[model samples]
Target chain A: MFRPFLLACAMLTVSNLTRPGLQPVSFAVEAGKALAIVGPSGAGKSLLLRAIADLDPNDGDVSIDGIERRSVPAPRWRQMAGLLPAETGWWADTVGAHFTSGKPDEASLGQLGLPGDALDWQVARLSTGERQRLGLLRMLMVQPSVLLLDEPTASLDEQSSAQVEQLLGDRLAAGNTIVFASHDERQVARLAYAVMSIRDGVAEPPEAVP
Target chain B: MSQYIALSYWDVVLAAVFLAINGGLSLWLDLRLEKQLLIASVRMVVQLLLIGIILKWVFAATSPTITAAMAAIMAVFAAREIWARQERRLTGVWGYGVGGGAMVFAGVLVTVLALTTQVQPDPWWSPRYALPLFGMILGNTMTGISLGLDTLNATVHRERVAIEAQLCLGATKWQSMAPFARRALRSGFMPIINAMAATGVVSLPGMMTGQILSGVDPEEAVKYQLLVMFLIGGATGLGVLLAVGGGVWRLSDERHRLRLDRLQQTR
Candidate 1:
């Protein structure tokens, strides 16, 4: 019985590695928890998340709750397992228009420490920090089951960064799986429940301490 | 009428001065080589002299077939220029497809629907009737196609992310590129809109001036100019709309994903 179980796990591992550009890099995250990825630039941290989100064309197997990510239609997968890159693009003229979900609630904006009237402002008028905050708000409005953030707070000041961390913590408590990439060790110490370092294209062992 | 005749010499001088100014500006801008300018000047003298001689024969013969042949030649020349101005080398298939499609569709629609149905000319394709009409339509179509292609290419380059993001968001290739399609079509038609606004009072259009110079009645010239304006406007609008709308769809794959690599390779 032990031998059969080991054989089944090996077969599953082999099958996962066969995906294009996707090697079997193993990491696990519990539902409603946050996993922080720390790596040097060009270490494939963003690529890993992109593969899981199926944004980068890749062959390896990735799943959300045992459902293969590729098996889902692209739009449906994006709706559920969204990746937010460092520089979020805004296509609409006004900040309020970016949200397909109704205008972002004042409470949510206030939690991010953004002005309540921010939704009415034109995207061109917003500062870089404001854009980042709005980008984060837009992603949360989607109500994604899995959130992949690539340097989400890289542009924010300490105060705004703390506000973002608090908001993310709230989301985690509410049961959303988060996989975030950051080069900042401080951010990892503050928000990461589990920290994994990526070097080259491979994932390193999770270090118990941030 | 006597006063107008007396001012004909001044008109000739004004036209010569305008041509000199255009030539000087072209030289200043380095848009013309000395050799090319020499060739162009020689060609202009030869071609216009030959046309002057031929016009006497055309007027004498009044042959509709000869007029039709001239119109066809003008369309072919305009099509060649349109094909050359596109930055990417379109497959011969697409060039011929867009060129022949615009010429035939616009040509037939304007000539039949607007011109013949409205004017009831003595011989529908008379040199006086067909040649100028064909020239105006073909010129506008060439301008429209050039603008459409340039605008489409620029939009693809500038808004690549928005396009890709839309595609990743579940938009089929065509749906993803809808913004570019709209921009290109709008750019292609903008000149037509501006020309329509500036017609008559702001500008004494070429055909109207030519008719007046050729001793036609002023009232008759105005009527023909009005008809030609509507015909060219309709032809250009249709040609641009069809060319841009059809051209954008071809830039994508069967999956509706834009084959950007293919476009970049050509560039």
Candidate 2:
């Protein structure tokens, strides 16, 4: 049984590199744990996430729970390994239309510290903070196995930032793996169970903490 | 018929006035291009006069072959304009594809009307009926195709990440670029929509005025205008949709990622 599994794994590794730059970079994201990536800008932190989520061109290896990322179809990969970019895109006219699954109702809005009637609010009227909060909430609603966030709270105020951290903490406690990129050392210290600092496209060894 | 001639002359004079106004404004905006404008006006007058003389003979001869040849010539001119507007050295393959595709698509539709509906005096090619109709369709399709290609290329460059995201999500190459493709197609057809809306109000259309000038009854001229408009709408719509859609397919690779660098270099 183990022999067949190993062969299957080898085959997956080969197929993942079919596109020149589509292979996932090797980084194990444990279930129920949060891994924060700290790096200078343009260090390929966001690109790494994109690659794992099959959103960027790459060549290497990537797997979720030993299942090769490339073996899974892209839609399934996106649904399973969701990436929340620094600036989330809202395609619909109203806030309510952004959510595909859950109702964008008063309770959900209130949870995100938004006005109850935000569901009816036009996207143009929303501030950057509001848009970011809505983007986070939209990602949460998807209930993916892994969450890849690219500086999700870089733009929010301290109070709003703390709220977002708390929300992520709650989700972490409930057993979801998150890999987020940030340059903020304080945010990294607060949220990271393990920190991987990336430099010039290379992921450095994780620092051990007492 | 006498009344129609009077109306045609009146319409032509109004068109000339409008052209003069536009020309004056253009001159005011850029005095440097005055020479260019003069040259363009001269070319237009000479070309139209030549076409008029040739068409007079075509109408007198009333041969289907000559009529078809004239239609083909119009298509060639339109195709050349499309190529020049793109500013790309379309390899022979692309040239054949764009030129033949646009011509056949527009040609078949126009042929059906001219042959079946008896729009012209002759069964196959009535220069009076076919030439003008062909010119309108060819001109519109040329603009549409150029706009479609330009919009498609621009969208691909701007929305690379979104397209990649969609592609990674199991969208085929066509599926990945579908949004941009749709946008291009929309831009291509927008002018046609504007023309349709502006018809008979902002401008008196060319065919109606011409028919009225050349001794056709006002009511009869109006009918022809309506028929031509509908035909144009149908022919151009089909031609542009196919041209843009087919062009997009040719632009990408088997992987579905747009060849951005290649397209950029060409531009």
Candidate 3:
């Protein structure tokens, strides 16, 4: 009972982090469940994701499992729950320079269609889609219990997108939680158990992903 | 000590002839800096002349209140100068408090500590010692803090997404901002460090030259210059830390979220 409750505590929950353009938005993603967020462009989808990641300033509560985000301290909470924004941040020039802790082997990189020596490649040289996949791989390296992904696979072609979807599916099979925003209806339908759409800043009630 | 030759006002005015030559060259070269040069020279003369009179009274009276009031005014002006130089300034009171407050606090503290401990003058409030030393420390501190504030603000702007992402990865605000803060502090300390390294090697320092002109023995002047340098170094370090620390505080909330909005200027 205690162990299951503890696992439940690892779920991703969002109350709000508001911008002037956004209304208070809230939702939860239970363990192993993927909540797909869909909206028209400028419906505060990215902003909502940022808020959940505690990147933006807004009034409301976000928690993991049963612990309030405020209680866990931001860094630990973020480590446990990760947010991969639509346009991922690349500060280091080399791919290998990005990850401080996670060192994935050559096979994993190959699986992601990256060369073994790709770690040494300059970030500026990487294509947009490649950067997108690498960003996702880096986040997974942190081994977050919950993932907040904003348009995680938007940049990838169909083949790369399929690989990313497979990787995400694997992550879910491990019983981790994910709240992802995507524009592609098919991706949402394939990945999400529940679908929530943003209309006028607030999330419409979630429905079964058809 | 050797008796140094004194210069009359006419002798000082004789030095102004070189400026006219420079101004003439600027005009002939079509650099168009004649007006600026003329205005700067005139302002310098007027300002120094006024300060000379004020210092005369301050030295004679030797009152703590007067000394404190003068130091306060200088700090306030230094704060304004620092605030004006920042590209990304904290809004409202914060702008003044972080940069200016750090400058004044570090400047006054180091000056007072150095004065009382190393260069103790009679009555302690001797404007002769406290005023000049405070000015030197404050000037160095002002530069360090201004550079620090600019670097910090620029870091927030440049690294907002990256920093925010770090925080999302479960970094404490300090952890998230550590690299940026280190960079800011390094840049802030660069000027003082360069000046120290170059002192007497690349160029003679102003205070050493001034003291030699005033007939102080070269060795004695060297000692005073060293003391002032040490004070300025310590004060600049403190000011830079305060600036970087204050910036870190202003740019983040307790929730470890990066407050990029705080970096916005009202202007």
Error of 1 at A184 (Å): 2.8
Which residue pairs come into collision in candidate 3?
Answer: A9-A65, A18-A58, A75-B170, A75-B171
What local distance difference test score does each model get?
0.70, 0.68, 0.84
lDDT at B22 for candidate 2? 69
* DockQ for the candidates, in order: 0.17, 0.15, 0.67
Better of 1 and 2 by TM-score: 2
lDDT of 1 by residue, A1-210 (tens): 001111111111112422233346776677767788887888788777766666545566666667665567666666666677777766668888777645676788888888889888998888888888888788766666677888989899999999999888876666677889998888888878788887777777666653
Q: Model 2, B77-137: lDDT tens per residue? A: 7777766666443345674476348646875776566556756454545566567667776
Clashing pairs in 1: A19-A59, A19-A60, A20-A59, B173-B256
TM-scores of chain A, one for each prediction:
0.86, 0.84, 0.91
Candidate 3 lDDT tens digits, A54-133: 67666788877777877776677777778897777766779888876566777777777878888898988999898888
lDDT, model 3, position B81 = 94
Ten residues in a row with the worst lDDT in model 2 chain A? A1-10
lDDT of 1 by residue, B171-257 (tens): 566766777888888888888788878978699888788778877788998898877877777888888878776677666654344
Q: Is candidate 1 or candidate 3 better by lDDT?
A: 3
lDDT of 2 by residue, A86-161 (tens): 7666545788876664655566567667877777889878898988898877766666667788998988998888
Ranking by TM-score, best first? 3, 2, 1
TM-score per prediction, in order, is: 0.69, 0.71, 0.94
In CAPRI terms, model 3 is classed as medium
